[model samples]
Target: MSAALKIEEEREWKQEQKQERISPVTFTTDRTSSGATVYNVNRDYITHINVNLSPGCASPEAMDQMFKHIHATYSTPSLSVTRLPRTCEPPSDQITTTYLAVDPLYNSAILSIAEVRAMIGILQIMMVNPMLCSSQYLPETLADLKRTMTLMELAIRAYRHTDLVHSLSRAISIGVEQCRGLLEELTLNLASYRHSLASGALNLTRKYVWARAGQGSTMDALDYKLRKSHSSFAACLLALGYAAWPELKRGQLGKDTLDELAKFYVELEQESTSLRHIKVDTVIVQDHLGRDLPVPMIFCTSSQDFHVVIAGFCSGLAGDVLIQRGNYRILNAGDQVIDPKDFGTLFEPGMAVTMSILFYEKVEERQGIEGYSCPRCQHVNSRCTGWVTCAKCNGSFKISPEESIVSPETEQHADTDFIPNERSLFRKISISKYAPTSRRAAAAAASPAIANMAPSEPLKTENALSDGGVGDVALDVDDIELDEANMVEMNANTADVGFGEETYGMPFYIREKGTTNYLTSNGCRRAEGTQIIVHPRKNDFEKSAQVFYIDSYGALYHAASGLAVDIVDDVPCLRQLRPVSGRPNPWSHPLPEFSFINSQIRVKFLSDPAFPSCTDDLYPNGSWATKTFLLASNNEKDFHVHPISDFSRWIPTSDMEDSLSYDPKKRSEKTLRVLVERRTKDVGGARTSWEIVPK
Candidate 1:
């Protein structure tokens, strides 16, 4: 190196003080990235910064100065902390909720180089336009996410020696106060925002919740992704914060929190897989190829009232999916209480069966980003995982951050569970020849009902006993019970309401009461009057969805796959539903109560028309889609809080599970005054009544 060149380098590295004061403070919603809102910058015209930002010779001081100046400059928008309306009108006022992204592995707090780079990338995007934060919302949130990610990484790096780990554990405890505080703030902010906005006005809807009314744009999705990334980081911090070295050594965390973490991953994988199989690629996530990506799966929830189970799916973050137990809440900042009363938690993430929360990268989809084999290396990843081997070294590599992009087939999802398919609502059923065949089905199937519904071919008999998946049996149509009381002719009064089970991926048959015929899958294809008859076949490409999971929160999820049972409206028909991974947590509602009904308990849908049994009477939305184990409710109110509400019930309809095989002959100490909802031949709507039942 020559002396002149050395001097030039030294001069380049010299940090210079500011030459002049930067512009005064202003605000702007328009940001350079066009993803999120920026704060205190001149939106009227572009502002240029003159500084070299290359490494070593790069001037960070100059960069900082430019950033400071940008912060100083401002363009005003209507941002006020006070007088934000709590109540809203229709459409705009349609109750909505905001959810956090899913992080099953809880890797946000870990200090891996790859994760750090990803965290930095996310922060850079947020800080890029620092003048557009939602006044108090995004600003504090971005700061917290950025700070915790960096500090944890630094803390771990400082503890390279095993002995050093002990010395530094206490230091982490002291420094993490800010991270903990910020996490609390973010949680409360998210909960309150959802609760307020769901019942609040519509246009303001976008301000707090993303993907509202299905109008969520590209930017809204980006913002949603950013939050999920931050959440992983937060959960990581919360788990590690204040821990002693002993706590670290044991690898033990509070079971409750750990269970929640388990939930996060389980939910993620389930939702993603379900979406892909169903071909409802509505959720969007980052391509896992980049080292600078956060937990890529968004959070998905059960599509039922007061659903507590949260799940998501991902290809990155060391797993394909994650799940956790979560509920939303409304907490005021600085008030500092997390109890449900003070903060008002709502665990009901309304309608995971309706729409999806994961938004896809529209631009990348157009570029044909996925589906090619590595012909040179003979590698096929099914997804564009950015797998590459150096021609010379055979070393592995990731798609460079400079080229970081997204792949949608990881079930390219946007927002929500679609709506009430008549099958989903489980409406009136008649003979296939007698069923309605005239109407048009919706443009898309919300549930997997269309693709995975019963086979489109004519009803054939399938024997129940076979080694193959939903294997080889021919069902005898004569077996269908013909008792007049159970099989009344079609008429308004004593009307024959048929809600034949339309199990796609065919499930075990359990006959409905008074019907000799077993409840079975009826192929859905905008076709009506389909017979609920079984088809004989050994399962091949089809995945069997058996072993239904009914969680404590009254959510009925497919155990093998985390897909929730849901319905769609407009052109009512059956649709299998799943939430996309990596979107914010769905807004939640209060969890419902449970009761024991001779082992098998049932959940009810509390609505204007409550679910009543075979009383020779029925209504459209009443008992439709309410599964054998699950119930439906139109009442969006506090079904969880009020055990006395007539809209809710826990009946034991052949509910004999292993756990429910209690001492029914004896009245135990845990006896509960169960509020059962029932309708009769004389009643107008179902009413709630007390039934003494064992817990």
Candidate 2:
């Protein structure tokens, strides 16, 4: 062979030897070394990262999802079989090559500090060029940013606790540098913009200003929002820096590096403190970025300890706003140390500042209740009574003829003995107390012999109540038996109170608070979608007007029908616990449970855990999405029961004529729908409250 040919062959041989040396390393956990459970690491962590999510997002679930994605993606092996030539045909139907196995137990972990850096990059992009994101996803992106900062502070704490401070100091320093760069870039950009306008390189037009007025606000407002966003971001970075102080000071670093870190943190503290004196345009920030995510939030951190307050608020304080130098506690707007329990319970997590603002600003009106005044002394009393003894004047007088101050409506129905608006709930009252006050009176009036009988005389009835109400005199409010064992023992399966029919569960009257009205089903109908309404108690006991019960899951179910109470189109209606099963759509199914809030005074529907797009864990509101809405109905279908997830089908089908109608007679009204108010009030008043009144 020629010298050139020989050289080419030698080069090819060397390339093959290099390929053999660089082949993938494989291992198995087997002690015998048979290699039956061999595994290979593909190093495809990037494929595990979700591209759809903004790189800055770092919630615990997001981190866990990233890990799961990596685990699932890495376990699948690629096919690289080499086919043999037909000429080598001793038994030639097959092809052969090397096969590598993947480990099913393999999982990957990511550095939390890397996630923090990604968050900084995204925030920089948002501050510099927010237009790159669509308008709808802006809120989600801001939420991601807030979550990222929270995780960063938590990771720093973990590093200090786990003795990883020395190893993580380099990454923490890099993150701090990135944050400093971001602050500098934001400051320079704003300065350059102002300088260009001052130098006459850029000019504002009247039309431009007017157009922006309709859009939101002026250019100055935009500048304010940008500045606020920058300050808040800086405050967060400063907090993280303080949290990682132990890690930062772990190694023997050069004087220049230490000085640089100290200078950056000091500058951040100044910016954060200076902006605190200025009134931040919180409304604009909320509108642009979203509430609790990136408003004028304050983060408290300490250097001596791993103390970091996530979204703690500070108002009207002097000096070093970012660092909690001494107290190491989160202060609320009231300048009081916040309780730890308030984090995810009272207000949303990382939303103490926003909630405080709304509580002080938006809640302006107070609910008033009118009280009865004494005719002689003019002393106001909470409840009306026939006699009143004034505490201030020490005078006594008769206020009304009826010794007990009952409403006129209640007096008219007194002979029927209806218990209206029994407010003290969650307590057991005996069956004798729950019995109609007029039942004994009516029985006495029916027979003169019974009226003439002595007070101690033992009267007889076949199916008397279980609470020893066999023969009892008319009961006064004070004479009623309370402090009983339980409602189930006192009233369950009893016949004396006139529950001849079987009840599904513990029967109770859902009465409007401070009123003589009760939540009644229209007529005694057994229809699936019977309209639930508030109406005056009737003399005759009807199953429709009598009973409602709460199930184990907090769903209020009408005893007459097995259906549960749910709000559809803002109207309370009866719906099946579960809609028709096996439906292709899950939203077409009604949510299984409803919940009570504020001591069972307020009721709100709960989302299904299995519902599509429903988050697995609770968010800041203690729920996925729950907000208050007015209770009103414009059309009959508004009261129609539908699936909880079927919110799209709740549009009213009423005509314009019906919607615009003002005449009460012309409107197709059967029963009055329950009016849900923002505040609760007393009974016998126009604005009444609700109570769980037992039968």
Candidate 3:
């Protein structure tokens, strides 16, 4: 936007203006009052992923544990790729022979780019998504993926959170995190190739070719560039490795053939850096002093209508950008215009935001398969959306993508990647940003104070019924079936038991969708140290939790604690309060007779419309604490407790479609989908939705 800026300097700004375009088609829909239309604000082109995670726990420590589990279980992270030689070439004649040993690497690097694209950008896509890491990775890539995933799974397994959704989410998240390295590594490879190839051109020109004032020198420079920058095996054979093309056209090879090859390589290099790669001075850091830090960084001149990002740098061009006022526009990264949801998807609601320019230099190498040739499929410049399925062995690969170019042992120099140990993860847990998106703050406006009790002398079973709650008797958990259509609902019958019955028996775990943790308990003890917690599934998690529901008033009696979670205040922990003959306790919303949500039950205690808001208070401390309800026993000594409330839910352990067992190794084609909502109202579109694959 600066008036005195060079046309190339202003190119990025102009390019962004061209990218802000209108779509081919538009549709209109009614807006909702519950919240904004967060689903499709990116318009028709962008995709949406919503996680309606709301945790249920009384203790701040317990809440913290659940949140920690959610992040630990499901999060994506950026990974650094293998480092390479930094001795890049400059445009000038100054050449450093000190890096001569790394010269052959220039040829290897160009081939490396092609191979990465063939693997990830091509063949790998034929595996599953062919775009993400998993069983789809080439054998070598698969080994790396397994290392990362095994660590993630081992981390979650060591904990006691038992929610089905969390387990699946954590598994998929690990794949996403590891897959990031693939694209990043590709970019780095291209950067190295660009630098070395340019350097090779400069070196070839200096050693050969005469410095004549006129004719041959210009042709020599062009010929040197083609033989180095974009040279393939075919090009080398055509020029016979000649640095000067004087042997080209008028000398020996036809002029049109040499001229055409020269023009092609130059155009390819220009198109490669079509997007500007700019680096800013250190003054503009991504910080909190005064700038919007959560959103994707944008670049533009103060006066330009468009925006751009520092994609990569060229020491040769001396920061020069390729610009022709491009013929068409782009949707930019993520294929969407700048919007608030991009940042909202990152941080918590109401977190302060500041907008400012970014200072770091952005760089990218050609990582995608759009322009690379596929080795197996013999496809030229494969344009598949991350795909190149094979004909014989399907998508199987016998070699690693890196090894295809040059095996690790064959390389002149190599850098090793850092591997993490499982034991170290237990001592220090680290979860990334994406994990929190599936969870929401469980704090309310006013939290009831739970009383802290001291450990009392152990009590006998006879005294357990002193609270006048229903006594818990042993029941067969296996009697429960994954199929809801054949099973009898609590309201199925009459005088003996069923729909109008006074009491109904059910055994299940209440899982928090956001944290993927379960409501756990160690039963109630008469001692002062008896309090419950709401957290994750661990090695010794209680599988049989028999809950007695008093149908008339919704009194949820915990079989383990022999006490009902009251909707009362002044209780420090979830179980501090006892049930009385007062207002109905927490309620349960039964799923309608819909075949889709067969055996699902939603239990919401906090934030229920029938109850007054007194769960959270802006305590003097900078933290917001809210009262939570769950079945737990006090243990200031690593005590585990079960979370109870309307927010908690229980479904069959089997796949949602009943097509496979919960622990089966194979996946079924049928989708195991579950519908969730903030309230148990009409079965319309809910704010949250989830899919479960028990395996």
**Among these predicted structures, which one has the highest lDDT?**
2
Show where candidate 3 strays beyond 4 Å.
1-503, 512-516, 522-534, 539-541, 544-552, 568-695
Please report the candidate that would top TM-score against the real structure: 2
User: Can you give the lDDT of residue 279 in candidate 3?
Assistant: 21
Residue 205 accuracy (lDDT) in model 1:
61
Q: What TM-score does structure 2 among the candidates reach?
A: 0.28
Better of 2 and 3 by lDDT: 2
All models: lDDT?
0.27, 0.37, 0.26
Q: Could you give candidate 1's per-residue lDDT for residues 1-695 as a string of tens digits?
A: 69999998777545221211234343322223211122222223222222212122225476456545544543222354111122223323322221111121111223232343454455445445422223334545455456545545544432322222322332233223223433344344444544555443644566544445332343344455545555544443332231222223323444543444344334434433322322111112122111211211111111221111112221222212311122112112221212321111112212111111111222232235353322223243344433344343332322321211222222232212112221122111110111011100111111223234354322233333335444433222221211111222222221211111122222232222232222122331111111112122234212232223333223333333333332111111111221111111111111122222221223332111222332333334333222222221122222121111221243222222311322112111111112223322121222121111111
lDDT of 3 by residue, 1-695 (tens): 56757776679657544444422232212122111112322223222222222122135466457445534432322243211112233333321111111111121222233333344443333334321212211434433333333332332222112112122222223223223334455444333433443443644533342233222343343334322222222221221112122212222334544564455444334433421221211112122112222211111211011111211111112111211111111212232223321221222322333221111110112235344332333344434332333342232111112111122232222121112221111111111111010010111101111112223322112112346664433211211121121123322222122112233333334443444544433332222113323434445424333222222223344455544433222122223221111112232211011111212222223222222334443122211111112221221222112223322233222212321211101111112111112223322122222111111
> What's the TM-score of every candidate structure?
0.20, 0.28, 0.16
Q: Rate residue 239 of model 2 by lDDT.
A: 45
Error of 1 at 158 (Å): 21
Which portions of model 2 show Cα errors greater than 4 Å?
1-144, 148-505, 511-518, 523-530, 535-546, 551-555, 568-570, 575-671, 680-695
What tens digits encode model 2's per-residue C-alpha lDDT throughout 1-695? 69999999999778656544543444432333222233332321111111222122356466557555545654343455222222224534322222211111000002333444465465545545432222344344344444444444444433332233322332333333334444445445444443433333233422353344332233344334434454444444544443335334634544544555556455445544543543422111111011332332222111112122222222112211222322123334443435432322323324443111100000011114265443334457666443345554443333222122222443443333222222111011111112233433333333434445565664443334558565534432222212122223334324212112233246777655556767776664544445667677766666455577765334567777766665543345565443212121232332323322221234433332223343332233323223332232222332223333243332123222222321111113634655332223211233333455557
